[model samples]
Target: DIQKKKQGTFLPKEARIQPAAFSMAQVAKKPLPKAPAVSIQEEEEEEFKISTGMEPGKTYTGQKLDLDLQDIDLDNVFRLIAEVSNLNIIVSEKVKGKVTMRLKEVPWDQALDLILSTHKLGMIQQGNVVRIAPLKDLLDEEKERKRVKQERLQAKIEAAKRLQEAEIEAQERERKLRPFVTEFITLNYTKAKDFQAQIKDILTKEPKLERVGTAVVDERTNTVTITDYPEKIERIKQYKEKVDKPTPQVLIEARIVKATKNFARELGVQWGAQYAEYDKRGEWAWGVSSATGSGTTPPVTPSSWQSGSFTQGTGRDFFPLSGWMVNLPATLLPTPPGIGLQVGRLVGDLINLDLRLSAAEREGLTKIISRPKVMTLDNVEATIKQGREIPFTQVNPEGNVSVVYKEASLKTTVTPQISPDGRVRLKLDVTDDFPDRSNANPITGNPEIVKRQGTTEVLVRDGETVVIGGVLEETRATAEDGVPWLKDLPGLNWFFERKTRRHDQTELLIFVTPFIVQQD
Candidate 1:
């Protein structure tokens, strides 16, 4: 009745109220309930919901946004980005700068980062909540966290150190309470007393164990008794094992040859000739002959001294009138002619003799004095002697005469060191002593002692030979023989008398070879 007059409406259907308006009106009629009071932490948790299908601590790939902004507040920009990305953002009070940027289709997270960087601001994200603050405040918080972590680590280290010290103290106390153990070790080559001395020296250096360790030597059994803690005893046993093995032995073979300068080469040739003769007859024979004459007497052929079996033959006359010539058997033809020189024609033919002679002339030229082979322990000196001792009368201050013996001999002394690589280092001392018959004492008629000595050190491989030389001796002599009255005439001396000058030289050569003896 009150609305009897109906007003005409010109509103379009699209602009009229929809069915949702009734529900909205009903919702407004309900009393607005009071929101529960929330703490800052609760509010933050409520604002930030974990993103769906994303793990915590994962990099956020937020929604892309295209924004054209001009001098916008940094906090507003962060809020805008948070809204676009559906992320919870908290802006610090210290964040008050404005940013001007035009970003097209950039990730929301990246755009937020750009705004924060330009303003010297920083962010800390926990799950979906992002905190915005000044960079200085964030740096201070990070430093504080590191300082706390370092303090915790240092505390753990100190606790561990204290625990270790306590354990070491317990072990030391237990060791002191333990009884000493004794062990006996027998030595094969090394002296027990020597090793005991070494062990004593080692113990003296250890302040904690010096009083506890003892080493005693029993010479009768060549045994060393060690008394110490079990651990120290084991260490001593190991050390003894390293040093108590057998000492190596060295077999030194030495050849002492007194020869001329050309002896080595001439000896080689002589050996070759002997080998050739041996090949022809299956055996070789060497013969030597000598002839001596006072005046012009016809030379007599000496008997051939044979070294091997051969048929003897009657000699034929080769020279008719020359007293210097003699018929030699054909089998002894290889003997050097210089060995059979006649004393009558020796001065006349001496000028025509060859300086290089064969091995048959060894009696006057080259001689093998001695070949001494000795076996000795490594680093021990070995000596060899080949001559006699001479006696001399010594008158003391009391006017009593006594005989004193002096060694006049050829002696060789060598000390050899064996290396692990099968090499030998040798220290050599050689002495050659002889009587000088040409110079004799006036009253005693005793010859003066002539000594030649050589000393050297050399390194050579096992079983290898080394030669040592340089001791040389030289002699010169002159002789004249002829008819006495005719030789006295100065003008006719050349025709009647024969004068000869001879020069001789010899050297001492030592050939040494060392062999390492293998243990059986």
Candidate 2:
């Protein structure tokens, strides 16, 4: 066992080997070669090529350079030149495009000039910094600078002339006012308190008058006394004469007109028109018109009139209407989004409902009354547009499609302009969109909307009414009068299914008027 253990523990010579000691003879060093001398020009050119351009803040020595760049980027040229000149050159945002130049050993300044000239650019130098901008901008700046200089010179000359004139005026005023300065003067004037401040202001502002003492007034006799230069005294006398003149009275009469009727008597009867005092200036009168329709017009009802008033002065007035009358069917009401509905006399004599609902409420009511597959009157919407377009999206079985809003909003645009002769010029634009049920089929969703637009420019006098009419709309309503299954029978369909047909014709009328109110 011992002999086997000793053989197993034997060490190899290579495994126990040590590293050899260091020797200078084993390592050899080589000498570095000297670089060739380069000219300043050549060194700069080499640096320009390597660096492409100069940094904005870095400075360089002014050195001559020979560059012959063709079809090279202008930005690269600016950078190379910047590096050679050792200048902080900044290119403005206005500078664009490339530049090509061919030059022989040129000074930095000369090269910069040539480049700027070729590009229609100008350079501004401040200390060691340089900025390049459009040539026109620099020229404009120069013109403005010259203009300012000329103005300054002219202002100085004017100021000197004014000072001389003031001095001369003072001497003349002193000579003329010396005699009256010691004399006491009294004048009779009404409203002495109102004139006292004015008289003192006139005396104080007159530099040449040489006035002394403030004005003294006696309210009992309406007399004012003052001691001042003779010129100031004469001026006060002239002022007193002017103030003593009688003030003219002005009376303003305001007339309220029903505007619907041509006679002024009708206005008095409708609104109990009477002159109501407004301060001391004038009077204002207002009246109301009789109601012809219960918010909805008959298919052929007479047009209602607008209310207005007139005064003998220039003023602005507003004529607002709650809503217009339309004879369209209840089912065909154009209850588009953001619209208000006032239900009155439903389609035909069968339904006589007078209710007002918003667009959303009308839609809900339609769902309860109409079949899901059938298109009801609510399916049709009336739209109005005035010099503007509204867009909407329509979804079909295939996909969602975008469509421009062609429906008239039933709204009108009214602009009033006044002329020198007291005549009012009005510009009116009215637009309406109604559904065309004739093209609507059970298969298709709905037919396209019928569009109506009207515009007119008219001239009228204040309190005169302008009525715009000739707009006609027709709508149809059909109701089934038989049982569901029996109406669909093949042989007896006509007898079992009877459709009650009704046709409605409606018209829209617009009334506009201008009134003049007295200004305070």
lDDT of 2 by residue, 1-520 (tens): 1122122332222111111231212211212123344476653333111111222453533455555555655555665555444566777788876655655555656666667777788776544456677777766766766686689789999999999999988887766655545333344434677778778766744444544546777777666776666677778878888775433211111111111121111111111211111112433232222223223232321222233233333232222122332222212234231111111111111111112112323533211111111111111222222233434446677886656564434555555555555555555565555555565646444555655555545455655654443444455788888878988989988988787888754334333444544334
- Which residue pairs collide, candidate 1? none
Q: What is the TM-score of each candidate against the true structure?
A: 0.52, 0.25
Q: Which stretches of candidate 1 lie over 4 Å from their true place?
A: 1-77, 93-107, 114-120, 193-212, 235-243, 251-373, 388-405, 416-428, 435-448, 455-518
lDDT of each: 0.58, 0.45
* TM-score of candidate 2 to 2 decimals: 0.25
Candidate 1 local lDDT, 302-399, one digit each (tens) = 22121222233413211133332332111121221111111111111211222323242545666767778999999999997778888887778898
